[model samples]
Target: LVSYKRHLEIMGERNSYSKTDLDATFMRMKEDAMNNGQTKPGYNVQIATENQFITNYGIYWRPTDWGTMIPFLDSFRERYGTQSNEVVADSGYGNEANYAYMESNGIEAYVKYNMFHAETKRRYANNGFLVQNMYYNASEDYYVCPMGQHMERCGKQHSVSDLGYRSEVDVYRAVNCKGCPLRGMCYSSVIDRRSIKVNHRSDSFKKHARELLTSERGMMLRSSRPIEPEAVFGDIKFNHGFRRFRLKSNRKVRIEFGLVALAHNLRKYSAILSKRMMGRNHAYATI
Candidate 1:
């Protein structure tokens, strides 16, 4: 009983784990064969692919992609002796920590944050009430609200994550919204003033990431990102029937996935070679 309690302590916020396969964490599977959302014991598989070929793969106990990205990239660097020049991932992997890590490693982050989609919509884009839509003066370090109110920097704040990552934010507050025409639309504070907290570093990183994601080269990369890794996952899950790991524990599961990845690469290579040979035969026949 004491040992089971200790195991729970180690698991932390994770709700369920298989008693037999301790490494297999309980995660919501994406519509099983029955088309039902069922929580099942599984490992989060992270894969890096380029030109539709698997470059690196890692098995993580955590389900979310946010925390898995840094370690996955680290493993990729260790395996290849160099990190990728740029990374393109979906919003699930996008956060302040990942953005900061990519920046520190000198990799261009074309990742989207949680609010990226909402910000693209016409309502959110045109809404002057949102902090993002407000214009800020860089030199003076103050935001100009839609109602021509200056939100001055009031104080600084420090936030720490569960992983012990510390971020510094600047707090800004409008002088007054009393008797203002756009008071309710701009803010709903009882004090008649609007305040906002801005993580300047994170905001800067996201701005750069957003710019890269919208550029021609970035757009091309973004379009191809899903095809590269998703196709491999589709082949593994649907074609090869690898819905769940046959092994137990993190180490054994990693070994199982390593074999699967090897098979996938070999199959891709064979297909490419066969296509090239067929092309050669066709050319010879034409002559």
Candidate 2:
């Protein structure tokens, strides 16, 4: 029998793998063909598509989309010789590092974060009680709480991520709330004071991205972004029955996907040509 225990040590954070395909890492399968929420040995395939055509693709061992964006973009740059002017992605690709990278590379980001949707609800409206609802005076650098309390900057905090990215956050505290009537409603603190932390730079980046995402051009791109890659995924998975990889290693799997992508593009091209030909024939018959 194979040493399963030794394999587990080698695969930290990746719980399982196939004996035959050691390159495939265990990830939570979306379809879960067995309906048991079982982890399957698979590669997280990342693909970039434009105008419903696959522009670039990369097979990643990592399961999550968080840290995989940089490498995916790097692959795109390597293939195209330059980065795109704009990138439209869902909340999965929105983070500090990704935003910073895109900004530095002069790419307009139309991405959403985890709380973007939540903050749009009626409950999150400008009710004054919530920190998001509070109004800040940029000139004075102080926030006016719902109860008209001045929350001034108290201190600064520095946070470092696992990837060694450091972020500076400004801490703000309410001047005094010892006998405020809205204390319980505003916050649940026995000390009767409230504090809020803001990463100003990150917030600015998110604000810029949000503005771009809400613009007319951005909305058009956002609508088309889904149709581009999502349609390709549907065609590959449901239509072509490519739910699992037959190959064992990452390089081999990439080659397999390359063939699949090539076939898909050719099929699409043929369909377009056929439609044009039929249109011309119909015109000739009408004449």
Candidate 3:
């Protein structure tokens, strides 16, 4: 997570950030791990962008990325009047609350999920169930528990993203699996119940992502990303020689990064203007 604070922006000179604001924001982000609660240094950068232009910008030193998204998105909306329909980000941005926010606000997002999560991993007991037991009913959009139980949505709050129903899918456990014929290969655990939390939110997005990833437009949109954001980062680090940050606090770091981005934009804009002028001059010479 990266951030620069509002106070930093307010106190900083044209090119530098306020030291006090940077320390405060960094402390906020690192509050959990740094229990002692001294100034834990960190930073976050926010950029409002279109297909080829950055409209608004901000930075802060915050530890977690979770709290910053909505505030940044809202700030972007306030400045730019709205945003792209589909927000594309990597798995680090994936969270239940963020998904709910997207769904509620009518914005679609393409966020990756960690594969090891229970939602994606299907558990199987060697002695208990056959391959058929793990089958997902596409028509029904539900899973069959190992014990031949139909796991329906339990009318309970299972998690933070409780859409008012929890996945009530549990395995059909016969009380006497020890004496049952297929006990050995069916389950390894003493407790025969084989039902767990299935994240439907992640599942739904994965379906949406699959459809979009295969489309021609999706391919084109994805292809452009490496060139755009990566180019900006590369130029800042390599061309501009900004590998290590000179500033310690989040606020100063943000101010510095903002300047770097601004510089890149200005250079690109200047290059475009120069090319146009050169073209006009060449045309005159030809005439």
Q: Which candidate tops lDDT?
A: 1
> Between the candidate structures 2 and 3, which one is better when assessed by TM-score?
2
Which of candidates 1 and 2 reaches a greater TM-score? 1
The CA root-mean-square deviation of candidate 2, after full C-alpha superposition on the true structure, stands at: 2.7
- Over 156-244, each residue of candidate 3 has an lDDT whose tens digit, in order, gives 33343222322322232233344544556656777654333445555665656546644676666667766655566666667888755
Q: Compared with the true structure, what per-residue lDDT tens digits does model 1 show for residues 16-60?
A: 787777767888888866799988888899998887788999988
Per-candidate count of clashing residue pairs (backbone under 3 Å) = 0, 0, 20
Please state the error at residue 133 of candidate 3 in Å. 10
Residue 21 lDDT, candidate 3, scale 0-100: 44
Whose TM-score is greatest here? Answer: 1
lDDT of 2 by residue, 1-287 (tens): 26767887667655566677877887887756567776778899888888778889999888788778888899999998999998888999888999999999999898888777777788777566876678989899988888888999999999897667899989899978888988878888787679998888888888888789889998899888879889999999899898877777888999999998999888888999999999999999999
User: What C-alpha lDDT values do all the predictions have?
Assistant: 0.88, 0.85, 0.56
Better of 1 and 3 by lDDT: 1
Model 1 vs. true fold: TM: 0.94
Q: Judge candidate 2 against the unseen true structure and give its global Cα lDDT, from 0 to 1.
A: 0.85
TM-score of each model, paired residue for residue? 0.94, 0.90, 0.63
